[model samples]
Target chain A: MQKEENKIQAVIQINDLKKSFGTNEVLRNFNLQLNEGENIVVLGKSGSGKSVLIKCIIGLIKPDSGSIKVFGEEVTDLSHDNLDKMRVKVGFLFQSNALYDSMTVRENLEFPLRRHWVQKGKENVNDLIIEALKNVGLAETIDMMPSELSGGMRKRIALARTLILKPKIILYDEPTSGLDPITGKEISRLMLDIQKKYNTSSIIISHDMNCVKITANRIILLIDGTCYASGTYDELKKSSDSKIKQFFD
Target chain B: MKSTILKDFLSETGDLTRFTMSFFREAFRPRYEFSEFLKQCYVIGNKTLPLVGITGFIMGLVITIQSHPSLKAFGAESWLPSVVSVSLVREIIPVITALICAGKIGSSIGAELGSMKVTEQIDAMEVSGTNPFKYLVVTRVFAATLILPILVVLSDAISLYGAYLGINLKQVVSFDLFTNQIFEKLTFSDVLPSIIKSYFFGFCIGIIGCFKGFYTINGTQGVGRSANSAVVTATFVVFIIDLMAAQIADIFQIT
Candidate 1:
C-alpha cells in the first residue's frame, strides 16, 4: 500500500490560498492538488472564483495569502524571470480564446515560441506549428486571420497555440462555455486526446457537466471560494449531501 | 466630497508616477523589442504625416494672408515673410502639430491596448512568458516620444512653403526674396525652443495614452472611455507643456 501510494505524484499542490478584490473576497481558504496525468475539473457557478483559482496558479494574480507549489517550486515566491521560466512548463487557455487580432494564426503560434527563445531553424518552427495545428484539426488555418475563423475554430487554434510549447500542464478556463453542444463535446474529446497523448496533468474550470464527464478524472466542487467536495463523477453524483447533489441536478 | 475628489486625484497622480518609472525600468532591460519599436515608429510617424502636413499648410496660408495687410498698413509689406515665418516656426506649427498627434496617435494606442486588455489578450501574453508592457507600452511610448519632433520639423518646412505661396497670391514677391527675408529675421532661439517643447508634448501624449490603456477595466465601454480620455488628457497636457515651455523660454531670454 505504501509503495503504491509513493508511485502517485502530485504535479500541482495548493494550500489555504486566499485572494480578495476591494471588500469582496474572491477566494478563501482554497485548497487543491492536481496529480500526474490526471484531469481535475473545478466546477463552480459564475463569479465563484473558479477562474481566479487558475489565474493564481499561473501567477497572473497574486493570491493574498497561502502557497501554490508547482513541480515543487513556490509560485508566489518566484521572481518575474523565474515565473516566466515556470510558465514555459504550464499552458493557460483563456476563456475568450484571446487570439491576437492583428496577427494571423501562424504569427500567433510563432509569438510564444519567439518570446520564449524557443526559435530554432525555420523548418523546425514550421514543423512544430503544423503539428500543433494538426492536433487541433485545423491545419488549413495556418495563414488565416483569427477574425475569419468561427468561434470553435478560434478555440482550437488557441488550444494549438497552448500546445506549441508542449507544456507539462495545462490550465483551461471554461473551454466549452460559449460553444454549441456538438462543438463543446468535440472540444472535450480533444482535451482527453491531448491529455492521453502528452500524458499531461490539467486543472479545468468548468460548469458544463458533459465536459466534466468527458474530461475529468476527478471533480472538485468549488463553492464559496473553497473546495467543498471532491470525488469521481459517479461518486459525487450519488452523494446524499445537498450542496454536492445540487451540482448533479 | 471635496476630500474624496482630492484623494482620487492624488491616487491617479501616484499611479501615473509609478507607471512612468516602470516604463524606464523595462525600457533599459535586456531583450529589447527592436522590431516592435520600429513598427510603432512607422505607425506613429508615417501615418500621422499627411494630417499634420495638411493642417500646417492651411495654417500658414491663413496667417500669412491675415498678416500681409497689417504689415502693408504699417508701410512694411516686405516684412510679411519674416513675420509669418517667425510666428509659425516659433510658436504656431509646433503646438498645432503636437495637438493633432495627441488626437490621432493618443487615441489609437489607448483603444488598441484597452481592447487588448478587456479581451484578455494582454493576460494571454503574460501567461505565454512574454512581457506585454515591454512589447506594447514601452515600444509605443518611445516611438511617440522620438517621432513627434520629426513631425514638428516637417510641419514647419511645409508651413513655410505655404506662407510663400500666400505671399505670391497677393503680390509678386520672388521666392528668393521671401526666403532671404525669412532667414534674415529668424534667430536660433525662435526655432530651438519650439523644437525642444515638441519632445515634451510627445512624451506626455505617449505616457498618458499608455497609462489609460494599460489599466483598462470593465468591457467594451471601458475601452471607449480609455480612448476618449487618452485624447482629452493628452490634448490638455500638450497645451500645459506649451505654456510652461513659453514661460521657461521667457526666463532664459531675461537671464
Candidate 2:
C-alpha cells in the first residue's frame, strides 16, 4: 500500500488554453487538472468549442497560447513525430465514429496495428478484437461493414477501437449525442466500466444531464471557452447559484 | 446584362487563379498521408473502369462506322484500318477517355472531399495529426496520372476492333491483314505522344478537383458548386493540355 503514496498526480494538466479561428476566439483561457483515475465531465452548448477542446488535448488542434501536459510531458510545441508518439497514450472517440466506410470492422480495428507495425505472431487478431468488442458489449460483430451497424452499435465499435491502444487517458467527444436514451445509458455505463477496469482517467464532453449525473466525478461547465462552474454533482446540487442549480433541479 | 457578364467572368478567373495557388502551397507542406494515396488508387482506378470500358467500346464502333464511306469513296477502303487505328491511337481515344474521367473522377472527388470539408472531417483529420494533403491530394493525383494511360491503352485496342468491323460492313478484311495495316501506320511518334499527353490530362483533372473540394466553404450549396465547377474546368484544362502537348510534339518533330 506504501507504493500508492509515491504514485504521480495529475495525469493531464492544462493552463490558460486559448484558440481563435479568424476573428472569433473559440477557447479562452481554459484551465483544467485531472487526476490519474478521475472522470471529469465537461458540459457546453453546441459550437461552444467542446470538440475543439478535445481536439487540442489530442494534438489535433493547435491552441494559440498556454500549456498542456500529458503524463507530465509538455505537449504545446511538440514536433510532428513527437506529437504522434504522444498520441500512443491517448485514445480518442470521434463524434461520428469515423470508421472507414469502405473497410470492414476487422480492417478498421487492424488499421493502427498495421500502421504502427504491431504483431501477435500469427495467433490471429481475433482474440484481441473480440476482447475489445466484449468490453463494449459488441462481441458478435467483427466482420460487418460500418454501413450495416446501427448508430449506437457504431459508437460501441468506436469505443472498442479506442480501447485497442489501452490509453492512459480516454477523451470522448459527445459520446452519446445521437443515441436513444436506453442505448445512451449503456454507453455511459460502458465508459464507467471501462474506466474502472483500466484505472485510467477520462475526460468526457457531454451535455446530457443524466450522463453528467451518472458519470462525473467532477464537472467542468464551459461557457465562452472557460470554465463557468467547477464542482461535484452533490456540491453543485446543494449550491444556491441559479446557473449551477438550474442544471440539476 | 454587361455587368452581370463581367461579374461572372471575374468569378471564374479568380477561382482558377486561387486554385493554382492553393495547390502549390499544400504541395510543400510537411504531412505526407500515404494511406489516403492508396485509397485514391482504389477509388479512381478501380471505380472508373466500367464507365471507361463502355464508353471506349461505343467510341470504337462509331469511329469505324463513320470513317468507312469517306475512305471507300477514295478507293482507299483498304486503308480504313490503318487510318482509324492511327487516329484513334494518336488523338480521339485519349482525349475522349480523359474527358470522360473528368466527368466521372473529377466530379466525385470534388463532391466527396468537398462534403468532408463542409462536415468538418478534414478539420478532424488535421486535429488527429494526419496530413490531409498527402492523404487526400497526392494519392488522387498519382492515381489519375497512372490510371489514365492504362485506360487509353485499353480503349485504343478495342477501337481497332471497331475499324475492322466497319470495313467488313462493305468489304471483308481478315484479322491478320487488319492487324498488319494498323501497326504499319501506328508509328512510335503517334503512340508515344498520345500516351504522354494523358498523364497531363490526369494531372489537370486531379489537381482541379482536389483544389475545389479542399477549400470549399459556405455549405451544401457550396459543395454542389465546387463539384460542378471542378468537372467543367478540369475538362476545359484537359483539352488545352492536349493541344499544347500536340504543338510541342510537332515542334520536336521539326527540330
Best candidate, lDDT-wise?
Answer: 1
lDDT of 1 by residue, B1-255 (tens): 999999998998899899999999999998788999999999999889999999999999999999988899999998889889999998899999999999999999999999999989999999988899999989999999999999999999999999999999999988899899999999888899988898899988999999999999989999999999999989988989988998999888921
Candidate 2 off by > 4 Å = A1-7, A119-124, B1-43, B72-76, B112-137, B210-229
Q: Which ten residues in a row have the lowest lDDT in candidate 1 chain B?
A: B246-255
> What is candidate 2's lDDT per residue for A1-249, written digit by digit as tens?
554542367888899999999988899999998888899999877888988888888887889998899887888778867876777688888887877666688766765454344556334566667788889877778899988999999999988877876788999988898999989988899899999999989999997877777889999888888999999988888889877776677
Comparing only chain A of model 1 with the true chain A, what is the TM-score? 0.96
lDDT (Cα, 0-100) at B201 in candidate 2:
92
Please compute and give the TM-score of the first chain of candidate 2 against the native first chain: 0.93
Chain B TM-scores of the candidates: 0.97, 0.89
CAPRI class of candidate 1: high
- True lDDT of residue A137, candidate 2: 79
For model 2, the docking class works out as: incorrect
* C-alpha RMSD for every candidate: 1.6, 4.2
Clashing pairs in 1: none
